[model samples]
Target: MSLKSTVIFLLSLITVMAKAQIDTAKIKSYADQVMVRVNIDTNIERYVFTEGPEDKPLETILSINNKTRASFSVDYKIISGTVSFTPNFLPGNNDNELKGSSSYADFRFRFFPKKIIQTVYYKKVKGFYIENMQDFFPEWKEGKDAYLQFPDLKIQSFGGSTAYVMKKDFSLKSIYTQGEWQKESRGSWVPVIDYDLSIFTDIIDGRKNRDTQYSIGASMGYFYNWVLGKKNRVNIAPNVGLGLGGMFSSTRDILDDGTKSSKENTQYLTIRFATGLHIGYNTDRLLFGGKFNVTSSAYNEKGNQNVQNNNLYGLIYIGYRFPPPGVVKRNYDKIQKKIPIL
Candidate 1:
């Protein structure tokens, strides 16, 4: 389906489930409060391509120079939104002398409707350099060598995921957004369907080229939230998912003579894996946590070529919850009456 149709379908499903109830015995709801959070993270995006024989393969890894990001988030009722950007002033983020400069931005929104979780996000990244220059050049030294850089390469992605919790007692929100607190240890088998549309642009040999890719996948994820502490204020959650999908890509190349080449379309099968762990301390008014997560996907190209995209990140966050202002609550209630899914 098209991106617009998928979004409409998800919104319709959420509208239907908006009025559904939650199990209050196993989870504590903080819908009446507004939660605000600040997060600092090291989220690195890398793409690795390998070709040649299985015994002896040639690999090229491309990654951005910026290594640290900061984000601000707000949660109210069942809605949450976050905006993140690379902070160049941080320690490892400003190494432009060795690696070329890069820019990154991400915007995300999430909704919790009863047993369902829906997320939508947009991400943009520009500028990449070959991270493993020594693998190809034996004489290349780490701090003393200048790696190959692609200053004109850019990637933009629009994506979302819809997930369903099978166990009513398990609270995924407690681990994800901290909008709810689980009273006891519980686990669930959550099924997810995700889709994305990505566009890649680069300048090669004085010519501009662009590739667009559309992908959809379905996965079964297992999540466990282990509650501890005498006051049930501490929790540990671990989750993993495995899935398969397909990527359909169309490429266009601009000739050096200022003519546009015909678009070429290709298809490939993709395998994806995701794993994460979260440890947090939550109280009535405050919460603090740290998390580590990794997501990877691989696909094979023609002529014995394989490509993989890996996203690895570690994050620390602190949040506070308080009652919403009267004006804000009233305005949100009025809007919710019309949309119902808000």
Candidate 2:
């Protein structure tokens, strides 16, 4: 062949070789993929994950609410497998799942961190809880010295009850919870103290030596409640309790306007101090003859014993009581004749 013909023939052969290489790679790329699985830590909050001994990191395909989905063609690359997420959700199907849902139908796509997957954990930020207020008072009228395994979820509650608690007026003052519910054995709303350890910067200036001084505090709380008195009829409801680590870091930050930015970057800690009385009652549940405690608070700080100064916490509950089911009116004339105080 002439010089030009020889060059053209070589180029044609090179093109054919490149095409064969592409075709071969495509045929072998997906033959050894593996199936994906999931591990759950419902208690932990910030969703995290990891890879197992015989596994690789999953590429997140979706993440919303308490669900997540990750995709990986690597299954086809290794064990030739496919990924399908099955969610334990309510009211929906594969074809018509909810938008932005972590349900079975729509959780197959999530944003995954590009790295080796570790065991997934949740990030705990905030929750509602209750306080077991009976310990401090041994003479409580009802259910004194009782502790039901701390409440995990509180449906509704009232801070104090006349039938189940000691005196209508308790010296224990108030019961506070860090989370949402308190302890009532048979009632569904057992109180649980949830942690809402938040991160923020604050600037506060308070002179503690005097009662007139002011201090700013940020508190997190949980919610729970129980059935009171008449067998699931009346609710001693919506017990809300919270604990802020004694480390009440407060600050004053303002940007041009009077708005302040309370953002802090420090090692976070939630220290429990001074078992104070917690009294907060919502109007909806406390409508006995009238409403009860609009709000109640207590806080204690570490100080010198010589100072002899401490914040005094008090009790204030406003509610009405109904007569028991068997209560009957007496005949005034006959009763007065038998025992007359006049």
How many residue pairs clash per model? 0, 73
Residue pairs in clash, model 1: none
Clashes of 2: 73
**Best TM-score among the predictions, by candidate number:** 1
Query: What lDDT is obtained when candidate 1 is compared to the true structure?
Result: 0.90
- Please estimate how well model 2 matches the true structure, expressed as its whole-model Cα lDDT: 0.25
What candidate 2 gets wrong by more than 4 Å, as runs, is 1-212, 228-233, 237-242, 245-342
Q: Tell me the TM-score of each prediction against the true structure.
A: 0.92, 0.18
